[model samples]
Target: MKTYRSLALIIILSLSVNALFAQNKPSHTDSLMKAGIALTDAGKFAEAVAIYDEVLKASPDSKPVLYEKAITLNIMGKHDDAIIILEKLLTSISTPNVYAALGDAYDMKGDFDKATSYYTKGISLWPKDRNLWLNLSVSYSRQKKYPQAQAAAAEAIKADPRHARSYQNYAVAAYLQGKNAEALLGLSNYLMFGSNNQSLGACNVIKSILYAKPNTNADPVAKLEQETIAGAVTVATAGKTGLAPIDSLVLQLTASYKAIQSQENQFGSSFFARYFGDFFGAIATTNYMDTYTRFIAVSLSPQDNIAWLKAHNDDVKAFNIWLNTQKRQTE
Candidate 1:
């Protein structure tokens, strides 16, 4: 089975987190910083680095310029260079942002020990910094230290109860440890406040497991399955213009589901039978797969998929209910 790892996701989230830490500056440096950011956004990393160099020449101690330069280097896969800059920033300025960046840089370099150490130091300096706690949680999770990961995630939640990513971190840690109930609860909270497509995909996989297991507590499983079904419908219907083409979107979705199946298949027939075998069989028998493929093929655009799903909402709902009913009957 595929191990639950979030390194790629953490790297993606770090870009936005760095953006939030960008400092305000005087007009000259501000313009340079903005230009660098634009270049970075346009995938012109070398140009962004040159612009940052110009900003640094003007104000050698410019925190914003240095911070953004480090981020650009990170995007360029220069983790060592980024770490050198971040460590220098920490020596002159003891801000949580610099410490968190240092931690992320080390984590990217696969030095989880140093990453956890820096994250802990950052948390000590800023007890209320939820992102530090979240980063610490991820570091621990990556190291397979579930108890520490859970504790760090709990601290993040305590710092900011409404932060959706904290819940996601906790859910991933819990899921890896086989704490299915806690994982489901954390995932539910994450889905409640976050609209990211990746989170939706994780929710669907977790709900599929819950729906398949026999001798499990029925109440929470039923409630979570229903919520997952409703959330999938909502996501399917929320597309707008300018999204990926319908065929591409269909390919992406199918690839993601296929990954889940591949992971489950590694555990042999008993595990498959207990998890996804019956689930796949039921959907295949109901012609749901045929209808879904047909819809994807005929949809004019990504938005048209939403309209088609809405028009067939009743059928989709019926399939969900029937699938769950079949699972329960077998149980």
Candidate 2:
């Protein structure tokens, strides 16, 4: 599942949790499951476990109950318990989704080998389940096994050409494998079909490619603007684009300009909210906001856009360096 989908499901589970449990004087198995789901959503895993136990006590081998309990246990960081339940469930209920969930649990436990094992099992059981390959790729990435991760994610793309996570996973793996062109292609695909900001991957690549050159002195503003324009054109073609990062940079730029011009530290987070909120996926912490503001103070100093970019070029360089060293997601 996409991270956002998991978040959305948690929201839906929270809303129906109490209402589902309150009906008919206490609960049915469905009601109890809803209660467990709700508790899990609320981060009340222990309470959810009690509800899950109530169902299991009545029907010791209830697959649904077992699965729910396993998920809740994993949520509580109790991976071994969850894995045990998942293993038991496998005997009576063997399916792709189940195995995916099991693989996720194992991954969380830092057992990538076992995680990929279950993911492969899931794939064998349901070859068309594109998600299985994606999950397997993620496991491989976590282990720093870039080549294997790339192969699995590529399989996911072949299985379902439009699968966004497949591209994202593949891009990360390719980058780790030092296949810059492959990474760029996958990142472009992600921008078009997955996350709107391909810059999360692309800017770093540009910076790396630029930085790796000998005796190079690329104009910072021109380089950034050029890369930004190219990335924007690539991403803004359809419903697949997002405008948060630049929108965020603009707000920061303005705030720093105000502070520098007025010499009066007057702007508040409210200004950031007005612009940054429009682009960022979530509200940033005060510390992160401060860092951006500080960046602006340094970057916008000369009032010459070129000077500003040159002064703060290090931030871009740093982010690029970080991305370069990031291990593949599945390994």
Candidate 3:
């Protein structure tokens, strides 16, 4: 359950590279930067760095070149060198992207403390930057600070509700903290965006949680998890013998959503209670639970679910239509 796979570094680095190229107009240096990026993509880090250096020789202090070079160095495992370039960039330009790159460098070097520091600094400068919050969440999760990780992920979600990785980070933290219900809710939300290795692992964990006996712990969170699991189990077993795995899953999830709805008053102002509750609660009330079930199940085995999805293409389209009409709560 402690499995925390973060695509933040690579994803953010790619975004930064693309953003830099997008903002600057065409020029000789721009062409070089694109070439360097192409080289980096081809795993020719040395060649990419050489190209960046060639650009720097002509336009010294080129922010884009410096940033791209640092990124290349990071890919080459030259974290210290990356840090030096990023630090110099910070002295001249103060941007969340620079701070993010520096954090990535420190994180790659296995210095979670330094990485956390830079991510926190970036958040202070640009409080709404979802990438900083998301990366901070990753650093905290790596340090096994589950509560802080969850909180940081909440911020990331608040900043950008559509960012899939934030939900994945939140799910990992919540699941490791024994908050199974919250983890499932986060996983459902993450699957809405796309599937990946981490999301697939989470889907397996969701199955395990649904199948496990109810938690009898006295902790309030455990109690809620117990309630949710009980609801799922009861729905799955009641007069429904030999149900297919996907059918059982749909029933369990529908029941779990109902369980969450039952505790809406108890959930108070927590983000999961307020946001995830409303979103999934709506889906639970719809005829679309089967579609949603198959939708998420696709993450587990895309090939296996392909025929079913193809057969239910119209249902999928209707679900998407209904989904587009649903408004997500960010606050």
Candidate 4:
């Protein structure tokens, strides 16, 4: 009886130890996952993969770990490897993120057809996902299917009205389809909410076109153009010193010319000719006329004019400062 009791006590103690370890196993796995995610965030992709491997050895079928490893692989440009993992994950679980990731992988591989199919599948499963719609729009745009791209972009916009990417996609599709008016509107909307150099360049091009035409219809495009110019003038005049109104006008025009010159690549000589008349002709004609009129009205000697400009140099400096501020803000 004493030997049997001793054996039973040992068995109970062994079982309790095993139960405790079993309860702590998941905690250990969680720690491994957190460490892996940190490494991934720090861009140590290979190290993150190794940690994930350790976690997988414990939890062999962890969907979250598998998905995270696949994303890290994708970031490492191992699109094929990422796709393989994601495809296997689909066999066990069907999630929108997995499908979207597969679409991204195929898109990176230049397999737009496969990307589109995956994106469509994801969209069908999660119709309200703006990102999937945006991805679909991009894929369609890549195929030069502007109409379909526009439709997808519109859907993305409907899903999240504040998302700037949808507007960008819409602008591209509209521009490709020769819908200049709609393209300009979309670009303007993008500029209002987002800051991208490419979008800024496109906005400058569209603004140059509108400036050349000067639509009398009071359309949104015309209003945007007017507002842009007005904003520039406002910034330029913000540093007004003891200069006369005519002097201020001259300073504003000078600031405007500098602004246009800064983006000369976007608005070329043709744009200048169409909007402000020929560059050389404007210098010879309009500029000469303005100078003569100012000289006669002010009746100041060249030295006096120089002195006046030197005194108001702060205004010019202010305009330049304002322009730089705007560029930094937009970029």
Candidate 5:
């Protein structure tokens, strides 16, 4: 579960144990709270709820105890119960602080309109808060309210011009609204926001997700191959053994791939020369020069590179030949 975010709630959470002991004379409350927090951290939320309830009953008007109980209830998937406590807090407190908590609570209940109302209340009262609008946008989106979601995302962008998640949400909202080209552009902006220039792993993973959207009907098998190929590219580019001073080795293979994608696009692998529109030069570039000629058996078909690798071979030529021959063909 995405934990609710509100500075006042965080403040309350931090001082909760202190408030328990200081306001109520010495009791077993702090001990219970500590035990409850510890157990909850250990994934024992059910046990934690029992202890939280005892503490709340002992201090009926205590917001700290009530909030902690609500938190544990949420962790236990008791969203309705969590909503009750948070809503009750809202009525009695009626402050920006309470509005923030109520916003989070309603979001958990999936009562997104109320959540948006409360979040709006909090944002209006606390305009300088950097996090408020993003919180509102996410809640709006969970309910599939695209227009409202876009509005909230715009507000978030206005609040934090460079926020990456806001950009991603904007793209999704665009897609939901059937604005595919704009969605792709927004998604590209989201990718450009990242600073993973030196990390091929992140590059490949993001590229894989790019074409996996349902609209494109991209094949999962081909997607997996692209991702795996990218990994090998990353390892090669990062200079991780296999081929020493491997910059040339990596670049030759790099020519096998299209640029890192922000939307679904195909790589022209020799294995699918027909389907992917692969050219002989590109195939030869991808297939290591030495391996292409060497891996061809007497029958002229490429030998299986896996069988060669399994015996602890480092023959780059064989992999290239196998890769080229595997080019896509119509059945």
Candidate 6:
């Protein structure tokens, strides 16, 4: 519930809230909308919807209000109510936000096919909409269609390379398909955007993959990948004593990226070699690894690294500038 509710709120707030205020200006609808948002934030979802109903009674054709009301209904586990409002909105004037909300409502109702249909329709209308692609990928993943999920996630990433959620979805989809290298690369790119509560868990998964032993009976590519990761861990930790955990992680990541770069030509233009290998390989050659390490660590342990980020604002800025100018391989 938290997952879908949170995503629905993002779409609602991003597409509707500010626009509602901007268009309404100093109207009473503005005040009511704020109150409704406040109520929704305070977990008084019923009160919030009632406030939206009040606004709609006065300004009966308020699309933003309608969309937000539907989202709040979703958060309150009223998917049928949300679906009713969203479907009506779609009939009058279709928009990406309405499509996304409708898909989310159906998804929460355990109707993946309906959710996928709405998402696909939204993407067809707005091909550059990363959120639509992301949701479609999630729907496919829920149906255990890993390849389709990965392809949709790749489309999301190509649509908006800077969006963290795109990479996060891509990483999960790739990992589910047993493409660990691609998964690691996707996670690395995702971390570059920022960190959140998900950061620590992602970091732990990364370390586990880096340290896992090679499977003797695996295919050549998988076997080589395992060996590369295992060897990177040894190279990172060898002759090192009392290294801080974050420092150890930085060493291991750099070692792994460098090792992948070394084998880029061996794998020719395979997805991992062409995309993951070339991208992180470029970073391995730069002096930004320390800055990158601390940047991500800020989310891993805020108490320990937040001040470091604050104190080193220039470093963070420089690293971000370098990262943003770099292009990712989307093919």
lDDT of 5 by residue, 87-149 (tens): 886665554445655676777777777888889988988775545676677677777887677
TM-score per prediction, in order, is: 0.59, 0.54, 0.90, 0.54, 0.47, 0.83
- Each prediction's number of clashing residue pairs: 0, 16, 0, 0, 7, 0
**Clashing pairs for predicted structure model 3, backbone only:** none
Distance (Å) between predicted and true CA of 22, model 1? 10
Candidate 3 wrongly placed segments (more than 4 Å): 1-6, 16-26, 197-199, 215-218, 265-269, 301-304
Greater lDDT among 4 and 5 belongs to 4
Task: Report how far residue 130 has shifted in candidate 4, in Å.
Answer: 1.2
Locate the minimum summed-lDDT window of 10 residues in model 2: 263-272
Report the lDDT tens digits of candidate 2 across residue range 18-84. 3422323234577777777778877787999999898888888666667777767776778899889
| TM value for model 5 | 0.47
Instruction: Give the runs in model 6 whose Cα sits over 4 Å from its true position.
Output: 1-5, 17-26, 215-224, 235-244, 262-275, 299-321, 329-331
**What is the per-residue lDDT of model 4 for residues 127-218, given as tens digits with 9 covering 90 to 100?**
98776787778778877898788778877877876777677778778666554434544554465453444543654554453333333555
Candidate models: Cα lDDT each: 0.61, 0.56, 0.80, 0.59, 0.53, 0.77
Model 3: per-residue Cα lDDT over 196-230, one tens digit each: 66667778988887876766763686567767767
Superposed by TM-score, candidate 4 places the C-alpha of residue 112 at a distance from the truth, in angstroms, of 1.9
Best by TM-score: 3
Candidate number achieving the greatest lDDT relative to the actual structure? 3
* Candidate 1 structure quality by residue, lDDT tens digits, 171-288: 7776665544445445644654534546546646454544433324444433343343334334544564465544434433343233333333332223223333334434434546
Candidate 1 — which residues are off by over 4 angstroms?
1-24, 212-331
Model 5: weakest 10-residue lDDT segment is 293-302
Which candidate, 1 or 5, has the higher lDDT? 1
